[model samples]
Target: MIDFWLAAGLLLLVALSFLLIPVLRGRRAQLEEDRTALNVALYQERVAELQTQQQEGVLDAVQMDAGRAEAARELLADTEGVAAPRVSRLGKPLPLLAAILVPVLGLGLYLHFGASDKVELTREFAQAPQSMEEMTRRLERAVAAQPDSAEGLYFLGRTYMAQDRPADAAKIFERTVNLAGRQPELLGQWAQAQYFADGKKWSDKIQSLTDEALKADPKEVTSLGLLGIAAFEAERYQDAIDYWNRLLVQLPPDDNSRSALQGGITRATEKLQASGGKVAQAPAAKVAALLKVHVDLAAELKDKVKPGDSVFIFARATSGPPAPLAAKRLTVADLPVTVELGDADAMMPQLKLSNFPEVQLVARISRAGQPTAGEWVGRSQPLASSTTVPQRLIIDSPDK
Candidate 1:
């Protein structure tokens, strides 16, 4: 802090000195021009008097001419060495003294009283150290001070949300909306808060709010996504499908939501497929989707286990449990080193993991290199393979 203030003081002094220079220069120039003008006027008046004497026959032409020449010479000599009005570029050394003294004084004061050692002092000061309740009180005060400040209202609402006071949050957000006017993102965020505050029951009001947001911004991804989820929850599967489909087109190809979209599509499609709904059959080659998972065991576990070693190799589905999702286990001494599954497999087909599909199988290897389970070992995450062919898995949390 001392160093900063010293530097700032020096910079300010330098700037003031720079500004002073222009003023001094202008004054000096004006003085020099005035001196020059006076000299010229004096010479002209003397020459005029000399000429008048010669014309009045008071003096000879030679005398008048000599007088005029002498006046001219004197005028030239007076003006020749006339200094360019120096305003003592060094202004009495008082400013220089002040410049040095002020910084030193400022540094001393800062070191003694005002210096903060932490780099985050400014940030800490801006965002005070306080509980959520205290912050809310401060926010309320700030809002009262400046009722129309969008920033104040925004932070106040966010603070309410952070405190899990969704009703308060909704109220603040609604007030902000009224004051600041409609913003699709803000509207969606506020609507969510309102929905949670009012309970999860689906209401036309929530739908209307979401629809209004979507109308303002058709590709408002969060609102559209939430709307899809709400529709699915309401058993409006077709509506969910349509909303998700529209959202899918707007989403990037590799977005996480693609997985959810594929899940919704599959659920909808499965119902349609079972209901004998007409699916326009495309050409055999053109109508293709791929879903696949590849497993590579850790190098430490490879080719080290003996026949007696308990080894478990199976595929567990990724959706929910109680769906017979796991594949039949095989030992390390099994006939084929690599097991590949495809569409022909009834339980777990070899399908492209794309189409944002969930993992249909989990290949587990026990920690003891045995099927019985010393400690269940294998990748817990659903491996992303391909999305061209979609499939579903019924996976519960690992605790199951």
Candidate 2:
């Protein structure tokens, strides 16, 4: 901001120069005009002296004429190079007044419209914060500066949560949801924050938020973890185990949280067993089937599609529900690209590639960006889910 202000001041100086330079030049021109007039008066005085000498019979007519001509020559020499006096319609005061007002008006307009606060925020974020409190302060200022910025609000909410200010986090998350729409991840964050903000007591509002989030995305990790924690707190050991188990499946093997989640599941199982309840055995781990596919637009449909159109690729069970078992999304600009789909890409918790024995591949191009419905589509013949061969799918037929 210091540098920014310095640059702005320099520009203002440059602008002031444009206005002031002309007025200064006009003053210099006025001095030249005055000097020219002085020279004319001196010439006239010399001529009057010469005429007096001629009238006193000290000089003849020819001498008098020569003397007068010499006086005129001297006047011309003194006034040589003096330009014609220029008349300014604006006068002297107007330009000077303008020079004074230019900077003031410019600064006023800039303050009214410029993004100085945002610029300062950017500069502050460029360096690593010295402490968590300092970082939190900066995030708070950023959110204040851009109240409508969903990303800023989201980060502020997360920072508040980390600082154990759950009440503040809940409010910020609610603002984030309002600005960014009720996205699954945001809803999960909001629910978790609200749950903690309410003194760890469950409420219908938190339940609704979590349900909506999980319904939109069953693998929403935050909501799953929150539900598990709530169940464990309420002494519902079996329910806690179920939620934790679901969450465990979504975590990657290398994730640092996996061990902690496994520890939680073990604790819940032990609690359930202590209560004389029969614990369900964990399912056998199965290797997820990964299918590599190359998708492209059919040459015949090249003219029928736009570059910005959406492309959805998926595998569905050949004889079961129409819902995709695994799916990926792309754009028409990324056509002729290779993608891999597996259990990790399942749209729902119960639907997975490993659950199906045989499936068919599909590629759809939608101008409206709808995955289920599109303008054109293509499909592959039913094949075993475990097939390792890379299949090619081209979208050519009109969608029914």
Candidate 3:
């Protein structure tokens, strides 16, 4: 901000010069005109004195004429090299007033229309934010700057949820859904936020959102969790247990929320038993759209590659944008590892393994750790995301 202000001040100085420099030159010109007028006055006084002498017989006509000529020559010499006096229609104070108002008006217009807030936000984003509140403030400013940016609005909504401002989150998520086309994850988020913002009172709008989200993707984790909570609050213990159990299958093995979800299931089970309700057998886990791939390096390239070189393995929709839907990173030394790609490995909430029916598996060895370009690469033919058998990928060819 200081640097920006300094640059603006320099530009203001330049603008001021345009106004004040001409005024200064005009003052000098006025002074030159004054000197020329004084010289003429002096010459006139000398001629009058000579004429008086001639009339008194103290000087003859020829002497008076010669004196006048000498006076005229002196006057020419005194006024030599003086510029012609120019008439200024504008007064001195006009330019001065313009000089004063130019910068003031410029600054005012800039404050009203310029992107100073965006500049500050960009500067702040260049470094790590110190707190969640600070990050939230920056996000709010970003949303204000780019009102049509669905990605920005989505993040702001998530931040609002984290801050426990569910009402704000609900509004932001609604806008995000409207802009980004009501993706399953966004619909789920909107439903969760709206449910909480309504003071845990279920509404038809929330129900519609969750239903639409589940109808598109039954494994959408947010909507499942939200539904479980709503069922529990309604004292439908069996329903809560069923919803949570289904949600449990969608989560990755390392999900920290798994423990908390299991606790909820336990509580629901106990409540059902206390009410003399027979616990129904848990339903079979659905086959999720998880892909397991075995990655390896060609034996010929083993001698040419560094052990510490980065290896990026990802799955991307073959027909959509080239961005990875799910990704995993490792070093070249970790070749021959079998890894799973699923919704939990999604690079973003919207781009997930289950969202695309046909995806290709890719493996690359990038010394600089970039996923898009690398020295060696391997790609699989487009396959179903729900393929259960482990697939094989070998970095056997050059990236090109």
Best by TM-score: 2
For residues 46-139, write the lDDT of model 2, one tens digit per residue. Answer: 9999989998999999999999999989998999898999989999999999998999999899899988988988998999999999999999
Best model number under lDDT: 3
At residue 44, give the lDDT of candidate 2.
Answer: 88
Q: Cα lDDT of all candidates, in order?
A: 0.62, 0.91, 0.91
Off by over 4 Å in 2: 282-394, 397-400
Per-residue alpha-carbon lDDT of candidate 1 for residues 230-343, written as tens digits (9 for 90 to 100): 776776666667777767776677778799788887786667567676444322432232334344445555555454434443433363222323344555455234444433
- Number of clashing pairs per prediction, in order: 27, 0, 0
Better of 1 and 3 by TM-score: 3
Give one digit per residue, the lDDT tens place, for model 3 in 280-342. 998664455899999999999999999999999999987655679899999998988999999
How close to the true structure is residue 164 of candidate 2, measured as C-alpha lDDT? Answer: 98
Q: Give me the overall lDDT of model 2.
A: 0.91
Better of 1 and 2 by lDDT: 2
TM-scores for all candidates? 0.34, 0.76, 0.66
Model 3 per-residue lDDT at 243? 93
Q: Note the residue pairs that clash in candidate 2.
A: none
Off by over 4 Å in 1: 1-122, 125-147, 155-165, 267-400
C-alpha RMSD for every candidate: 19.8, 6.6, 6.9
